[model samples]
Target chain A: MSGAKPKLTTSAMIASLAAEGHRTSGAPFGHALVALAQTRLDIVGMTADLAKYTDLHVFAAAYPDRFYQMGMAEQLLMGAAAGMAREGLVPFVTTYAVFAARRAYDFVCLAIAEEKLDVKICCALPGLTSGYGPSHQATEDIAIFRGMPNLVIVDPCDAFDIAQAVPAIAAYKGPVYMRLLRGQVPLLLDEYDYRFELGRAKLLRDGADVLVISSGLMTMRALEAAKRLEADRVGVAVLHTPTIKPLDEATILEHAAKPGRIVVVAENHSVNGGLGEAVAALLLRNRIAPPFHQIGLPDAFLAAGALPTLHDRYGISTTAVAERIKSWL
Target chain B: MADPSTVSRRSNVSLAQRAWRIRRNALRMAAVQGQGYIGQALGVADVLAVSYFHALRYRPEEPLWEGRDRFLLSVGHYAIALYAALIEAGIIPESELETYGTDDSRLPMSGMASYTPGMEISGGSLGQGLAIAVGVCLGLRRKNVNAFVVNLLSDGELDEGATWEAAMSAAHWRLDRLIALVDVNNQQADGPSSRVLGFEPLVAKWESFGWHAQRVDGNSIPALVAAFDAARALTEPRPRVILCDTRMACGVDFLERREKTHFLRVEPDEWDAALAALGEMPA
Candidate 1:
């Protein structure tokens, strides 16, 4: 899919993903939201003209009357969601990550987060997920939303996490911003039998050489990299931090406190203010600094290309992550 | 055509009196703060009075009643005005008026939904209220709840691009239950609204966006009452906007004529005179 049309619409992007044999995790979110709506009538879905792309079409198809199409207005999408929440209704707002973090930041900040409204802002195309370019790829969404008070940020690794997070965020009151994996997302964590608990970091594998702290798609890559690294006899432990805010510090510290362990934080976000900076700060504050390194995007706008090329170029692919860990070891 | 001067008919005398009390309550609250957005409060008092007393169907004691009509204060700085109206409507205690803008008071300097009981949104950031109103109306429609959403904004808010975005969506959604009350005091923080940003032909802007637009004397209790009635009675699937052309500090003659009254710093002696000008004296 390299050198494909750069300006494909969300639907066109999804079709391209299908052509490439990639499945979307948006299916689980849409399906889970619909299933939740079956028992909880207060669940309402909203989108900024990206329902089909974000897999909100599933919810729309299931409950057409309950879905609201707010054209291409991200600000109104957030503001309206906040307003709906004010009326004692839980609104699941879907849009691209860039639009939510960049275009509608203030609305999310003031109307939703300030009031601690129960608005679930689930955005697709988070961090380097889109091959389209910086416009579609939200590489710094976590950093942007990290500073916001009373907002729960989640970076789901696969379909299983996305499915469980939908009901979990709905049940837990207040505002939440979750990065979405759209259009044929790889199902990996379920193979590991991972159960996503909010604000809890899960230790998938334990090794002595290098401890890889990861979240979102980076975790999937880390898990794959660890398997390959095992063939090389490099002992690697993977700690997946799904919830970025209200981080599971005790769990992270317990795994990272060991001496002689190279602590590498992997993320699909920017090197600044993301999981890398967060873990670095935590280690520095706790005086548990091992030989630490961050594997993520550079602090700049990424070039446009296909997902495979971009992932390799940005050093987040399975092979790239494996090679980096091998070199560090 | 009805004469503008005698627009107050016999039937609207009670509404006019209610407007007067709202204005007095605002004056009292402004006195508590020593200084506040008293001019905008006075200008929008009649609209708030008609909204709470005549137009809206809210259970005053039960501020969060699901079946009640929602009134969003988009211009959060004008919270003093809404606080006065809420107190008059019994949604808030009359004693709390003295605690306005004080420490630990529910009534903050700006209108916040988390802080104030009756406030539908935290509206200090201008240009957010209408978009939120559109969302509320859409949510209400989905729930099969028959309720109106009245968004009260200032002329300065028109400068915000997001407000126009909401306007277009509200009309596109055919949200007849949404009512926008734009207080055109023609004054903003920087300078006059016209000087800062020209929003003239404001009614045409709304009508072109497919809303039932009406320009009314915001200070006239009769005009406000009729506009609210006409807005509610419209059966068309179009949003309604009552463009209220009002004088800042309207009820009191002296304050109404004062220049630079957007955020008035009332003198110690002037508080009593301002109250007296509204046909009341200090208690």
Candidate 2:
């Protein structure tokens, strides 16, 4: 009974991603933005009635005069963000990832990306991070926006990454689509003293048995999987690529080119357009064909359930990743 | 190099003269493409003329000056019209008009903010400009920059739900610096804008959204000038809107008589005739 785990509660459906005992940072994006805005007078925050959900309420409270509550219109939110960018204010736009990628795609494409405005589109509940099923799951957001010109995409892994990415994207000249991890984000990378660079991939752990190239929360999962796999003598190297677009090609090619390691692209997105295909294409183009594999969500609408069940079912959880890697080995 | 449009930026020229120049510039730009949103350009010429030549404060040399007033052309097809005004305002050189719609041309068929100097936002996707203007107004207020933002969207754009969303936001934010200009030319791709989806009681609808709405004949230079002036004169918390009821292919009599002028494709011989018709009022 002491060793056995408690039953997963309904709260697991919308619980924080932070594992028990591991330190969690409270709304890194919101806090970082509030700090960055103190000096950068042009930094403005905006949301489409998702302030509290996306953790923009923190910034809203800090700078009530600078925050714009655009209500439920995602198109208007993106359109307004683009407009604010044009007027020389860097707008951090927050909403559900599904809303930004699916609902207001054309607006984001034409207004922000096309114009190359300095608008930070940070959306909450990326991929299966939301257990609200297909309605909330932005499983195809990366695939949807991967082809857009002038858009630099970021998928941060933890609170540390989110905190660093806030000012980095703000300092960046053009448009950025960042998958935000809000509400007690895991401060995982801080253990490794990792710094978030805009387009560079960080190699968190070195292993000869397998190379796990991952982004977003999947990277955190990959790190955990790496630690567990180490006990089995199945060395798992985790490459944390927060920036999805302008794929840290040199770093990826360098790692994938290494022989004897089974290179697997693990992502929280669909197997379709997200980082998996991107890495596969990059490897193929470079002719660095190692024993390749991918651990990702299926190209289908996920069922409504607890996120832990969903992650395990979809084969993106830490245990699932470790099990899949062992099977591949 | 010696274009009157460039020189006309100086106040020596009358608004009527400036409007004439804008129409000519648009026609010339259309001549390059052979087919475009020419009817829209022609109809919206008066508004563009007033905006660039009178209402907006912008430096020809520095189009992105932070303090300058902004003009958002929501309808990208009306790039010919806005480009014409830009050329007249000396923002874009007259030589660029010759390359309109070409592969390497800065003056593409649609208005792109990145390509053009004074083009504030890339507008082709309708119903987005008003929202962008609302943002710009909010930004200006935040920076405490005393500059007005004019969003010129077509009547067809009113059919978009985002426009109404922006309308509500502008009022909610108390963005007095925002001015929405609706070019109610009553022509859309499918059919007439009114019949396509009638935004009837248009002024009343805008008023309901807490805007200072005004309906005026858009082709009349005097009417447009007065509306623009009245819009600026008000320092109220409510955003201002000028619903300009305009005629498609205005000034070009023979083209105006044609039913489908949404994307007017003038006959090869009629380009000169249209230009000539633009010169003299239909009498």
DockQ of each: 0.71, 0.78
- Model 2: per-residue lDDT, tens digit, A80-156? 88878876788999999999999999999998888788999999999988777898999999999998998999999
Local accuracy by lDDT, each model = 0.87, 0.88
Q: After superposition, how far is residue B83 of candidate 1 from its true place, in Å?
A: 0.9
Q: State the displacement of the C-alpha of residue B8, model 1, in Å, after optimal TM-score superposition.
A: 20
Q: Write the per-residue lDDT of candidate 1 for residues B70-113, one digit (tens) a residue.
A: 99998999999999888877779998999999999999989988
For model 1, the superposed segments whose C-alpha errors exceed 4 Å read: A1-26, B1-13, B281-283
Best by DockQ: 2
DockQ metric, candidate 2:
0.78
Model 1, residue A15: C-alpha shift (Å): 9.2
* Candidate 1 lDDT by residue in tens digits, A41-118: 999999999998888999999999889899899998899998888778999999999999999999999999998999
For residues B58-88, what per-residue lDDT tens digits would candidate 2 score against the true structure? 7788787777888888888888888898998
Error of 2 at A284 (Å): 0.9
Instruction: Give candidate 2 regions above 4 Å deviation.
Output: A1-9, B1-12, B280-283
